[model samples]
Target: MKTINTNIAYKEEGTGEVLLLIHGFCGSSGYWGKVIPMLSEKYRVIAIDLPGHGESKALDSVKDIEQYALVLKDFLEELGIEKVTMFGHSLGGYITLGFAEKYNQYLRGFSLIHSTGFPDSEEAKKGRIASADKIEKAGIDIFIDGLVPKLFAPENVESHKQSMEEVKKIGYEVQPQGAKNALLAMKNRKDRTEILEKTELPVLLIAGESDQLIPADKTFTASGENIKQVVIEGAGHMSMYEAPEELGNAILTYLNHG
Candidate 1:
């Protein structure tokens, strides 16, 4: 397929096979701060701050998950990169699924960290809308304040205070319209379980044992000889921040042996 038009912003480091990182909602490339240094030591790492969420300009014309996947395809082609092992976190996972289904030509493999292949349930859709409304009425900061803490294991919040604050700082920078658009996209995302069920390529699923957003069981929708799943102890949704060392090791293991 020909490259679609896009102007995505990204951070690249080290040198080896490409490992693309797609951050979750309200996050930027900075989300992989600790993990990048660890993984980049052995392999090339490229972390992108998706449009409207990082330095990239918002795409007002594109409001669906399919468009987000196209944007990523163009991002890779623009850099002259041919293929990559993509790892998507939370909201990023939804986009990764879209990419895997439509743009698997560029994927060597892919992983979903603390994410699921299931679609948002009816109740979950309402919650997504509620969050968008909250951002519109109360403001982004209020929504971020309440959202960030819930992303961590409640018992470990005090210990991971610094990382929690860093996440909040990043969340605050998200463009309001961009954030709303993402919520709408997520609320309407399709079920992608079948995509994983049939893939023969290496597939890795990493879930936080204590993930407050997506349970470990939920992330394991598909299983096969080619699928590898790991559950990190004590981590919540943001494993990149809560347990970077363990998260990095899990990713390294999948890349090296899977």
Candidate 2:
């Protein structure tokens, strides 16, 4: 594990083509604990704790998705990594699109895991703001506890109680300021469908069959010869935890076949 100057904490293991794992909202690099070792066996795996979450330092000012993308650019530059295949979950997915839009030259490929290229709807924007406000006023513990369960398919809440608790624990570790910044970034993100439609780079869109947040259709909306869609059965948004073996196999297949 190493920390970049901007306090981006990352864990790197194994060797081969670089595979960067970016966790979603309220998550840290630890979110990928179950799958990283499996993937690392085949490719160098670098999992990062985005600013304000896990061991990373919070940014002093509010930041956008592009800003986060730039942070990743700087982090990779610090590591002397010129290119990588990136897998982004949720918020990480938005940042991946931003990175692809501006730093496409550095990308070998990218995947959206339980994420969307669509910008927040007006109603969704309002909801994000409301939740941010609630987190600010009432604190993150209650907010995270209530929210983590919703991220799972309703049916999974009880079946995956231990995993849900791990998620909540990670959520509780998020810097409040960092959480606020992320919400704003997500709310303000521009739709990046154009990148999906035009890029020559390989793309993988993975959806959890029971995901309540970003459904399979939404994840699979963009079609292209370079794009591949995979639906993980009996899983939800937290498929990396709920179905790591299937998810790992899907990723391995994409990396090898793409």
Candidate 3:
């Protein structure tokens, strides 16, 4: 585990070909905590906290998804990671798509977990602007409370109260500016379905059967011939946490087959 000067905080463990794990928006390297130990046994895992999240310094200018991708690219270059197998969740998945677009030769494969390749709908874009404005004005406290319930399944909220609370705490601690920047970037992200269509790189599309944010149907629509889709049953948007073992096995299986 190390913090690089690029304002990117990462944890590196085990050994083998590099596997970079990128967390979603409002998420940090912490999200990969459960899966890292298991993954480390097979591959050297580098879990990163995107700028403005976790231990990373907040950035003053990260207005779009490409900027996020550039930050990731810089982090890898700084570490001398020339080629990698990437596993990106949600917003991280979007960043992976951007990375593949610009640096496909540097990648062996990439996975999109509980994420989408479609651009934001007009309404979704409007909501993002409104959310960003609200975060800027009302602050993050209210936003954190309002967001937690929507992030997980109702069963988790009821049965896994402590885990849910920890997630909320992380969201609460997030820098408002970072959250705002992420929303702005997500709002402006281009439709990346064509990247999947054009690339020959192997892709693993991991979806939660009950994901509210990105439906299973949408995953199929976005997937191309080169993709292997894995749907985790009894999981929601937070599939990594909800079914870490299953997700880890799926990832390992993909890597093995590759």
Candidate 4:
């Protein structure tokens, strides 16, 4: 797919209802490599590299989640995608919440994959600043080495060596500026719990059984008639790699019946 000069880079496939896949921090559209083909079988799939990740260029400064959401809106408009279902992983989920808050008109439904609606704790905020500073002082490679391994459930790390390596590869490819910006954006994001209670659209919250970053308790915090939650067994923060089949089924079910 072509890159929009002022926005994100993306890859599109299939042809039916639109399903937008937004990658998490440190990931590009390539993060969805495994599930995109499966989802595209029944619906059009557009996976985008959020600014600063993948092949997408970095923004000049750290922008808030709202700004990231607007970037998504602009992307959809540029593609003439009037309505869509969104699946966001990690940081992608935060941007999705921002989209749900500001551009609900263009949404059919949305899912949070191993993600949360809560804003960062004060400690987490300080951690983000430190992470950014570390990247600036050192380099992205060392930072990625430390971060990528933590993303997997410890149990799965040994068994899923190839998968873990892929995650690390993507992490290593991340533009330092882009990763830093995402960290700042996530740090500043507001608690979007109200969007969960307010939007009439279907909401799917998928948590990994072993996600250390955002545990199931944090991911499963919201509840409503429109909300559905699924916990993928034996998975971690990177469910798309650890358990793509389960992730795909949850997404397909939401699209078909949500």
Candidate 5:
């Protein structure tokens, strides 16, 4: 693994056609831990720690979703990866759509997992601002502990408490500034629904049937003719953790067929 400090910390893995995995806010490349081994069998999975999260340094200025997309563009160019299949989860998914809009030709396809293409609702944006304020006041650990439970369905939290705790630990490790910037980016993101219609490459939208964050109905509504939406039953926002095998299978099937 390598770390490149260009406002963000990026890590690369495996070797083949590059498939970039972007994690959600308060998440790191570790989110891909379960799915990487399966994907690495066929493609080079480049999982990145978006700025302010994971090992990446926090940005001095707040970044918008488009800026994050540009950062990924620069990261890819630096690695000499001309073409890629991008996978974004949650916040990562939002950035992936931005990338598709600006750099679609550079992508073989794009996948959005447990994410949304719609701009944040006023209430959601207000909530994000409130979250940022909480992180600034109570510290990252307290915020993470409070946030993790809401990230998954109630059944998942009940059955996978340990796993959920581990995820919370990872969230706690995240820098406060990074988490704050993520919230700012998310709140300021624009709706990129048109990209779904414009991009010729196949698009895959994966949502957990039980995910309350980016519900299946919203995902289906945003999907175009070129898009395929898959909802994993018994899974929540963190589907890869709740149903890794199923998520892995869906990804592999799409990659193989593409």
Candidate 6:
């Protein structure tokens, strides 16, 4: 069901150890729809719409992913949830890292799906600035149409056309200001690779075998024994849509054994 806590909107289902799902840029709790039912069969799944996206209100003065992490702490406290195995996709992963850095007590473990803990390379920062400008000049729809298709592996683009559209539909709902703000937050995010590599807490790193946006090399940076990396075949950055079952199973295996 949909609920609001501390102004954050979320979808909660099933019951057991909480498994929190956080979606990427231009996404909401809806991005987890395909995998939630499958994973929720064995665990309580809570998917949140980050501020400024989905149904959540935007933080007008939001400066970085760290602020979003603070919002999440308040959100979880409001719900009386003390711990969760957080799984973050794309931009969501950055916020997760911030949480891990500042609030380890709140996480049992965490996963970064199709995301990296490294700071934005100069090239990426430039791209982010350009994207923000595009959102301001042309609005969300135009930018989303051009961006979503590139998230999929080239081979899956034609085959998963419907799923692509669904993603776009979700992207279209992102408030323009929210999208632009998210870009700025991401561009300013710091490198959290140390948290991923050195944390004693169990960590799961999932990479889409053919993700054009973030390759496996970037996602599998942690060499510590505490980290587990899985690459979903026939998938890209949008594995939640391209390979939900595989993605869900990877998470289950990690949770079961970690």
lDDT of 1 by residue, 151-183 (tens): 999877999999999999999999988899899
RMSD of each: 2.7, 0.9, 1.3, 1.1, 1.4, 1.0
Q: How do all models score by TM-score?
A: 0.97, 0.98, 0.96, 0.97, 0.96, 0.98
What residue pairs are clashing in model 6?
Answer: none
Model 5 error, position 214 (Å): 1.0
lDDT on C-alpha atoms for all candidate structures: 0.90, 0.92, 0.85, 0.89, 0.86, 0.92
Q: Best to worst by lDDT, what's the order? A: 2, 6, 1, 4, 5, 3
Q: Pairing residues by index, what is the TM-score of model 3?
A: 0.96
Please list the residue runs of candidate 6 whose C-alpha ends up more than 4 Å from where it truly belongs after superposition. none
Off by over 4 Å in 2: none
Clashing pairs in 4: none
Regions of model 4 farther than 4 Å from truth = none
Per-residue lDDT tens digits for candidate 2, residues 1-258, read 688786899888899999999999999999999999889998999999999999998996648999999999998998899999999998999999999999999999999999988999999999999999999999999889779987887788888999999999999999999999999999999999888889899999999999988998878868888999999998889998899999999999999999
User: Candidate 1 — which residues are off by over 4 angstroms?
Assistant: 1-5
- Report model 2's TM-score to 2 decimal places: 0.98
Residue 177 accuracy (lDDT) in model 2? 92
Clashing pairs in 5: 52-178
The model with the greater lDDT, 1 or 5, is 1
- Mark the 10 consecutive residues where model 4 has the least summed lDDT: 1-10
